[model samples]
Structures are given as structure tokens and as C-alpha cells.
Target chain A: AQRVTQPEKLLSVFKGAPVELKCNYSYSGSPELFWYVQYSRQRLQLLLRHISRESIKGFTADLNKGETSFHLKKPFAQEEDSAMYYCALDIQGAQKLVFGQGTRLTINP
Target chain B: EAGVTQSPTHLIKTRGQQATLRCSPISGHTSVYWYQQALGLGLQFLLWYDEGEERNRGNFPPRFSGRQFPNYSSELNVNALELEDSALYLCASSLAKRVRGQPQHFGDGTRLSIL
Candidate 1:
């Protein structure tokens, strides 16, 4: 079975500090990874996908097949970036996605 | 273009009762997906419908069922609801089956409370 693991339940960082939300997956085939974010009082929205290879809002994630990890990172965290981040993995042959427990990131002023 | 829309922002029901949640995908979108976000379970896939057909379903029991209409709107019906069934049900939509890289746009979700 395909599974996604997000080790951190909450991460707090000061503004301008670097942020990294860990994510790991267990799948046999080529996996499609995505990072979704939900801000306060807002609906969940897609932040970026591994397939795109383009950064969105200063966030970027690289697919590491060897380590089975797709960690989301940003060089400088902003107060507005505080939100809940979810890592998802789309397994082979399954059109649906398996999501991690999500990490609530709080950027302190 | 408008994003995905779901009906009844909040729903309250008692045990053994039935709860029906509705979702209308964005204009021209043919795929709709249902997910349950419980307190601790995160988001779990419940159902997927496209072109008025049930394409996939999660590990949820048969009590959790849904259907898509000709206009690409969908409804999720939960039978014999239990207290554990209380959660935020989210609805998302995409272009179609062939749009591999398209992200799923989501709605504000319906917060269901089972008494």
C-alpha cells in the first residue's frame, strides 16, 4: 500500500528564517508529489507539484526517489506564509492521492 | 472562473441518521472528488466521479456513497452516520481524467457534526 509520512505536527519559525516541511512516501512506481496549503479561514489550495519543477511563492520541492522524500522548502519564511501544509503522493495505477498528517507552520513576527 | 462549490456549509445530525452533502464542480470541469478531514485523520479520499460515473472509491465502507449528475455536480450520501463520522467533508474538482498535471481546486468544505 502507498503511504505518506509527515513527521512534524507543528513547526514554528521566526520571519526571514528558513523553513522545511518534511515529507516521505513509500511507493514502488514513479510517484507524483504535491504540496497543498490551507491558510486561516481559507480553503485548501495547491502550492506546487513536483512535476512542474517551478517554484510557487518561494516554495520548491524536489522528488528524491532514492530516499522516497519530497520535502517542501523556502529560503525565507514570511508571516503570511503561516498555514497548514500537506504532502500528498499519487501512487501508480491509483488515480487518488494519499496525504500526510500535515504540518501546521507558524511564522512568528 | 468560479471554483468548486459545496452546499450547506455546516450540517448537524444525530446518530443513525443520514447525511447528504452536495458539490458543484467548476464550470466545464468533469471530475469531482470527495474527501473527509476528520480531527486526526487528515484528509482521506472518499469518492471520485467523472462524466456521471463512479470512477474510484477509498477504503470507506459501503455506507459512504456518492453520485455525479449529468452537469458534473456530485452528492455524497452517508448512511447510518455515527459520532465518529463527524468531520469536514471537502469537495474538489479537476479538468478530466487525462489532465495529469492539473491540480484539484477545493471548496471551503462542509463541517458535519454527528450528535
Candidate 2:
């Protein structure tokens, strides 16, 4: 079974502090990884994908095949950065995404 | 360019009633996807439609069905709606050829309330 696991449901970080959201996946073959974000009253939007290997809005994630992890990180958290983040995996031939439960990031003002 | 659009921002239906949600993909996108997000729950894939055909579906039951039109628009019909069906139904669209790698653009979603 292809599954995505997000260890934390909610993460609170002080403004200017570094933040990290953990995600782990289980898949037999090579998988495609993506991070999606949803802000308050905003629609869900793509943040970044492993294939692109780029950062978005100061946040970045590295796909670690050995550890089977794709953790999202930011050097400094900001109040506007608070949102719900989801880790998704595209399994081979599935043609659909398997999303993690999501982590609600809270940046303290 | 305009993004995906979903009709009826909110709908309320009682048990055993039916609910229908509509979606219009982006201008050049031919793949539409449906997902359900219950309160305090994550998104669950519902169905996928591409090129006016049913491409794949999640673990949902037959009661939850949908179809894609020739124009690439889609509709989801929930029959015998249950209380658990109360959730936000989200619609996403992507390019048909590079679907897996293409980021899906989303609509604000239709909020369904089953009472």
C-alpha cells in the first residue's frame, strides 16, 4: 500500500524561528512527492514538488530516498506562513494522489 | 487565466437525499479530479476523469459516481447521502498528458452539509 505519514497534526513556532514539518512515505517503486498548502479561506495550492527541486516562499523540502522522508523546512517562520500543509505521493500507475493527514503550522506573533 | 471553477459553493441535504456538484476545468486542462475533505479530516480522493472518460477512482462506493462531459467539465452525484457525506468537495484540474507531474489547480470547493 502507498501511504504518506505526517507526524504532527499541529506545529507552533515563534516568528523568526526555524520550522520543520516531518513527512514519511511508504512505496515500493520510485514515488513522486509534492507539498500542497491551504491558507485560511484560501483554496489549496501546490507549494513545491520533489521533481522541481526548488524552494517556494522560503520553504524547501528534500526527498530522502534512503530515509523515505520528505520533510518541509523554513529558515525563519513568519506569521503569514501559517497554513495547512499536506504531503502527497504519486504512486506508479495509481494516477491519483495519496495525501497525508496534513500539518497545521502556526506562527506565533 | 481562469482557474478551475465549482458550482454551488454550499449545499445542504438530508439523509437519503442526493447531492450533485459541478466542476469546470481550466481552459487547456483535460483532467478533472474530485476529493472529499471532512471536518478535521484530510482529503480523500474520490474520482478522476480525463478526456471525457472515467480514468480511475478511489476506494469510494458505487453510490458515489461522476462523469466527464465532452467539454471536460464534470459532475459528482452522491446518492443515498449519509450524514458522513457532509464535507467539502474539492475539484482540481491538470493537463492531460503530463498529469502526474503537472500541479493540479483547485477550486474553492463546494461545501456539502448532510443533516
Candidate 3:
């Protein structure tokens, strides 16, 4: 079975502090990972994908095959960064996406 | 270009009734997907339609069925609605069949409530 897991249900950090939202997956084959964010009163949207290796809104996630993890990280947390983040996995040949329970990040000023 | 669009931002239905949800893929998109986001549970894939064919489906029961139109628009019908069926139904679109790294554009979603 393929599964995505975000260990932290809620992560709180003070403004300017570093933030990390851990994500892990279980798959037999190579996995494509993605980070999606949903802000208050807004639609859920893609934040970044591991293949792109691009940072969006000061956030970056590295896919570590050895650890089976793709944790999202930011050097300095901002108030606007607070949102519900979900980690997803797309296996080869499957058009469907498997998503994690999601983690809510709160940046307190 | 317009993003994926879904109808009836919110819906209310009685238990044992049936409910239908609609979605229109973005211009030129050939694939449409449906997902359910319950209160506690995470987003779960419901169905996938491409080129007017059902490519794949989640673990949901046959009561949850849908079809795609020639225009690339789609409709999801849930039979025998139960209270547990209340959720946010999200629709997404992709240019082609989902490859390894293709990102899906999403709609705001329809909030369905079962009484």
C-alpha cells in the first residue's frame, strides 16, 4: 500500500524562527512528492514539487530517498506562512494522488 | 486561462437521497479528477476520468459513480447519501494523463452536507 504521512498535526513557531514540517512516505517504487498549501478562506493549491527543486514563498523541501522523507523547511517563518500543508505522493503510472493527513503551521508574531 | 470550475459551492441533502456534483476542466485539459476531503480524514481520491473513460478509482463504493462529457466536463453522483458523506468535493484538471511530475490545478470545491 502507498501512503503519505505528516507526523505533525500542528506545528507552531515564532516569527523569524526556522520551521520544519516533516513528511514521510511508504511506497515500493520511486515516488514523486509534492507540498500543497491551503490558507484561510482560500482554495488549496500546489506549493512545490520535489522534482522541480524550486522554493516557493521562501519554503523548500528536499526529497531524501534514504530516509523516505520530503520535509518542508523555511529559514525564517512569517505570519503569512501560516496555513494547512499537505504532503502528497504520485506513484508511477497512477493518475491519482495519495495525500497525508496534513499539518497546520502557525507562525505567531 | 480559467482554472478548473465546479458548480454549487454548497449543497444540502437528506439521508438516503442522491447528490450530484459538477466540474469543468480548464481549457485544453483532457483529464479530470474528483477527491473527497472529510472533516477529519485527509483528501482521498474518488475517481479519475480521461478522454471520456474511467481510468481509475479509489476505494469508494460503486454508489459513488461519475462520468465525463464530450466537452471534458464531468459529473459525480452519489447514491444513498449518508451523514458520513458530508465533505468537501474537490475537482482538479491536468493537461494530459498524470505523469510522474505533472501538477494538478484545483477548484475551490463544493461543500456537501447530508442531513
TM-score, model 3 to reference:
0.98
Where does model 3 exceed 4 Å of error? none
Tens digits of lDDT, candidate 3, A1-109: 8999999999999999999999999999988999999999988899999999999999999999999999999999999999999999986877888999999999999
Measured by lDDT, the strongest candidate is 3
- Candidate ranking (DockQ, best to worst): 3, 2, 1
Model 1, span B1-115: residue lDDT tens: 8889998999999999999999999998899999999998899999889899998999899999999999999999999999999999999998888355567889999999999
| Model 2: per-residue Cα lDDT over B1-115, one tens digit each | 9989999999999999999999999998998999999987789989989998888899899999999999999999999999999999999998885545567788999999998
Docking class of 2: medium
Query: Residues B16-89, candidate 3, lDDT per residue (tens digit)?
Result: 99999999999999999999999999899999999999999999999999999999999999999999999999
Best by TM-score: 3
Error of 3 at B42 (Å): 0.8
Q: For candidate 2, lDDT tens digit of each residue in A3-107?
A: 999999999999999999999999998879999999999999999999899999999999999999999999999999999999999867657888999999999
DockQ of each: 0.70, 0.73, 0.87
For A1-109, candidate 1 gives per-residue lDDT tens digits of: 6899999999999999999999999987778989999999999999998999999999999999999899999999999999999999875544687899999999999
lDDT of each: 0.92, 0.92, 0.94
